[model samples]
Target chain A: MTADRPRTSLLGTTALLFEAPGETTLETQRRIWAVAHEAAGFPGVREAVPGMNNLMLVFVEPPRRPEEIEQRLLELWNVVAPLPIAGRCIDLPVAYGGEAGPHMADVIEHTGMSVDEIVERHSAPTYIVFALGSHPGYCYLGGMDARIATPRRKVPVLKIPRGAVSIGGSQTGVSASDGPSGWNTIGSTQIAFFDVNRSPPALLQPGDSIRFKVARVLR
Target chain B: MIKILSVGALATVQDLGRTGGLSLGVGTSGAMDPLALAAGNILLRNQENTAAVEVPVFPFKVRFERSTVFAVTGADCAGRLDEAPVLPWWAHRAEAGQVLSLSHPKQTTWRATRAYLCIADGVDVPAVLGSRSTQLRGSFGGYEGRPLRDGDELPTGRSNGRAVPGFGLVPPGLALPLEADGVPAVRVLPAAEYDCFTNSSQDALWSTGWKITAQSDRYGYRLSGRELNPLRPLELRSHGIVPGVIQVPHGGQPIIQMRDAQPSGGYPKIGTVIEADLWRLGQAPIGSNVRFIRCSWDEALGASADIRRWLANSRRLVELHCGERGGR
Candidate 1:
């Protein structure tokens, strides 16, 4: 194994996490997705969920020999290649600023940019889905412009409505459900990110790409 | 069928939890005290993962529309069937129109906050995403996807007619006791960023008693104690987190995620309360102080084994006792 190979840690006896070393990149995330696919089929493994650049393997039952599984994961990490998934590019029509986005002014204050400029930069890039988490159908997307990055709120909001598009630090994503959050909301989308009645509930998955379409600037 | 005459807040139908949905960001929303749920099911001869009503608040009242067997487990709620007192952790057959009332938890024997109402069969709710657990965030599953309210009626599954009344089992909390400095404690295993915290902070985590703040709930337990400062500020990318993960935000107060915790988070993790002991923590009352006992990987696994053994033994004993009694 290399000096900075992936590290493994236990998330209690319920699950174990395999975090890739170095910077978080699409390349590393792709590898994590690949590992997740392979690990999901392993004995005693219930689910292999891909995070930003990490993979958490939840156990159906706590393994008697966790070290053996760790060794196998280590060996698998060394040999497994990045598996690129053929994913769909979803277009999300977003209404930027105004009351829908309660924290647009905060983002403006932090980025020192005009509302129009902020909207343009935010929608410029087609973001890739790094993972689906936080709440049902919520996507952790990559490729947000660094210039628009804003620090999370010191105190998290008691509740943010679903479809609220927001940015936190270098990451950006849309809230899939109405719940508490600390991210700066910049816009709102009408797309239902998740529906339990639908097969494969989450609207987006790892490897999918999202394009933000300017529906109407509420500002 | 059972009609909710009076119900407290946050009472919902739950099974073993919704599993295999983490990748889609769906959390495992289920009973906080799963051990009590399991024991209740065992007493009534229901399936291990059968759905039950998890009652966190007190003075819950329900009327049996039909004669059915049921068991009340978890907190000793001083349940009464009509005017007859019903023993905690015992199976009983309720006649049609009989009202079952559970008062405030006495805390005489076990210091618990929640109670499980396990019917002979289970709560008949449509399983969404392969579980009957109430997904509060998504607003789906369980009884109309919400907590049981007054006048709400829930259908019970077809009873197998195997459950026999007049039998009881010891509560697992008493059978499997864990403590540190005479304070209730749960085992913890260091997590991914355990080394990032300063030595003193790490030491304090193991040594101090953290009070469960009023903010504690199914989502997470906000613990108040000595600040757990890291070696330096740390920023983490969002990742999958399970129940029992101890996350330290910028404020350094540790928040222990529970069953309804988001499927993912970005806060730095210092440790996780082993899953086997999550039931103990779940039953811990608000404002109560809980100690953390650092444990090795092997020891954590052993604790899990211990719980499994307890359940198995209890199930076997219940089966033997019920079999001896035969049909009443």
Candidate 2:
């Protein structure tokens, strides 16, 4: 028998993916996470992780087959989606060039904009946090202009300093911890993006939006 | 107590791993070869989830501070007491002030097998995210928040008061039950990007035996195979990742994720390895030719359940080896 449900993908044999129906990315993600979260709260749901565009769903109880979950998720997606939920917008202050952004030279060369001009251009737009979690509080923003998209470092560094703002292709992120990264450093922030003791350990989450303010505040 | 005569590369003590901390981007660092550790613990009659030593390049040495009972499980290597040969995959005992030496093998079989030195008690490291795993990236858990090193004196817990004499050791190039092969057949279930690959690449993923690259480890296995051209390299929403997820990057290189992987990722995953064969794959060594075959969830569950059952039956009553688990 054929299935009637929102677009679904199987993750392993025990998990189901629910993609929301929408022309735009955000609309689809909103639907996806809503249903995924609801399913996560269900009795047998093991884990529910929401992404910028999709949600990963897993089952807890054995014999909780993917097909059965798929059918149930389809019905759940139909009901739980279309709910009212607005993503948050987080503002960040950054100091591009000099030390904060070691990759500023590369960004300048790619954009053909002087250091000062590049900082002004980058801080002008409010970008959406398309996703997060490559690093703690590291948000992946996707509204970057094609002209400014720079290729990642050919040789990745083993430890990128915390709070270092970096870019790879069209996306920019604020690194919360020292890590091995291929992203080009564009700036730095003083924000402590993640603290396990904090209520919400991560400062940025998928579906959130952020606008950078070019300023120096590293303490 | 044990004195690490030599520190192996990127070694640590780990169990199954931790969860619920992906929100902070903390990776789950557990044993690379979970089966080996499981089997090792089982051989010693310890809890399957007990933390064990995870060494990379060379074997580690330990000088017991007190008389203790323990086990050595996983890959066959040159192990001994004061240079006397010893056998792997078995339990052993030591006296106070005794120096136990182990030398690294050529890795003719598994890429890595962490030794679970299950004492008369068990390792006493603090638990983080519901496990005693060592997250090197987050720098939490395991021995002193890292791997064991030279001159480290770890405490032992209440002993079971039993002793297992050390097993006999074999020299290098000796015959063993497991041998390193180039690539193994790993079973998988398709993922969200299963359709992204071209039909040929999809078939090749199963049909053509992919060779394991040199850069294989607990985090992931990098494989060299025919690039599976997906329908699109569409940016994906971040999703929780499990061990064995096959993630294909820009060049068509498929990296099979392992136990220490981050909790989530954005790369388009084609499928995940079946749980039953995870241990076999763990032993396959670099340059092994590997293929993937799809299996139902039933098969995966049955195999993992069997492993757990085997562990429960085989584990011994070991005393505590590390300190007590503290609040994170």
Stretches of candidate 2 off by over 4 Å are A1-5, A13-15, A23-33, A61-64, A81-91, A97-121, A125-132, A136-159, A167-171, A181-185, A197-211, A216-219, B106-114, B161-183, B231-233, B312-328
Query: Which candidate number has the best DockQ?
Result: 1
lDDT of 1 by residue, B77-137 (tens): 9999999999999999999999999999998788998999999968999999899999998
Model 1 error, position B43 (Å): 0.7
Native-referenced DockQ of model 1: 0.63
Query: In each prediction, how many residue pairs overlap at the backbone (N, C-alpha, C within less than 3 A)?
Result: 0, 28
lDDT of 1 by residue, A1-219 (tens): 112778888898888888888777888888888888899999999999898888889999888888788889999988899988868998999999998788999999999999999999999999999899899898999888889988777556769998899998778999988898878899999889898878877777888899999998877
Could you give candidate 2's per-residue lDDT for residues B1-328 as a string of tens digits?
5656677777677886666555456665777667667666554545667777766556678777777766666566667867666567656767788776666654664344445455655666778667788876655667766667776666555655443444322211122222223344666888867877899988887778778888777767888878767775554435566677888766677888777665666566888886556666665667767777667777777666765555544442222222121201
Computed on alpha carbons, the lDDT of every model, listed in order, comes to 0.90, 0.64
Query: Residue B24 of candidate 2: its Cα lDDT?
Result: 51
